[model samples]
Target: MATQREKDAADYLQKHQIMELFDNLTSMLFFYRPDNPREFLVEQLKQLKLSKQTGVNQQNLFNNSNLDAVIRILDPANQSYITYAQYKHALTTLGIKDINESPEGVHEDKISHETFKSEAIEGLQRCSSTYIKSDV
Candidate 1:
């Protein structure tokens, strides 16, 4: 029931929305570091902020048992560093089938610098309400 132009516009919007989510998640996971940022420390996951309204308790999200299982799946080398590729693989292993396709239009293990920059700009635009000037 949609015209071709409207369908194209909707698709474009959805693509950009997914890209934004990917950019934000990547930034959070990698701590905004892009130099050799292919991997992240397991400890980083523990530092994520959780919302109480989500009803997901810390015991379930950050439990030692859960961490150990994830580590086993993501860090087979036991090196404590989980690569982006491994993380994606872990998601797939956990029944996440739509994990590989990235907003970049190709499957990639790590986010590029350009993507990070765009995400930063968008973050700044949304900062007035959520962040203080001093936080910058």
Candidate 2:
């Protein structure tokens, strides 16, 4: 029922995963609540483009602040750790698929702040690389 132009637009967006990009951008904007959201988004997009072009881990979205915020969100009680299940869920939400039973620095069912930060960084970097390669 869509016009040709509309269909083409939808196809283009799907091909480039624009919606997914927007979803991530919006999520970060809300979580970080930067005073200059326009600037923040611009910087994130620039980093993504750079990463895609050079295959470098230059994206600022996976910085320590954002990762720390993610950990805090997952650990609402400030228990200094999240369960393995919680960590997996967090990774899944970030579009990271592959998960090991136990990554370095993480033990048992508890994912401490340092462990979560380290694991999340690696997972996010992998996801970013995969996304860049596939989308290109």
Candidate 3:
């Protein structure tokens, strides 16, 4: 629950509209065009206001089959050069004995074959460099 003070603060902020005011100020004049300056300015203001009021969800904004095919080609395999022993040794060396003691977590940052992650590739470089030395 929001505290009384928090509610009061939010109410005050709503009236002030600090973000809206800042947006207006920051976008006053970028360029003075040669042709129909006022019309261009009005259009620009309309676009800017609409964008600020309603932010775009860029991740789900695009849908292209060609792009998806390209991504599939570039995607990495879950299988790596790291031997099981190398993985075990690195974990042991890093004092991570309790790892895999429990069932593998569904929401873990670790990689699965089905759902690949860019972060996992970076982690493989950082935390398990020794294990990934061999090209298996």
- For each candidate, the alpha-carbon lDDT, in order, equals 0.41, 0.75, 0.37
Candidate numbers sorted by TM-score from highest down? 2, 1, 3
Error of 1 at 11 (Å): 20
lDDT of 2 by residue, 1-136 (tens): 9999999999888777777677667777887899999999888787777778887867435688878889879888999888888888888887677876686545668878888787778877765543363353
Tens-digit lDDT string for candidate 1 (62-92): 2335446666655566554555555545545
The window of 10 residues in a row where model 2 has the poorest summed lDDT is 127-136
Best-fitting candidate, measured by TM-score?
Answer: 2
After superposition on all CA atoms, how large is the RMSD of candidate 3?
A: 17.4
lDDT computed for candidate 2: 0.75
Question: Which number leads on lDDT?
Answer: 2
Instruction: Write one digit per residue (lDDT tens) for candidate 3, span 61-123.
Output: 112453233234433442423333333343344333343422223334332322222322333
Query: Which residue pairs clash within candidate 1?
Result: none
Assess every candidate by TM-score.
Answer: 0.25, 0.54, 0.21
Instruction: Enumerate clash totals for all models, in the order shown.
Output: 0, 0, 0
Error of 3 at 70 (Å): 30
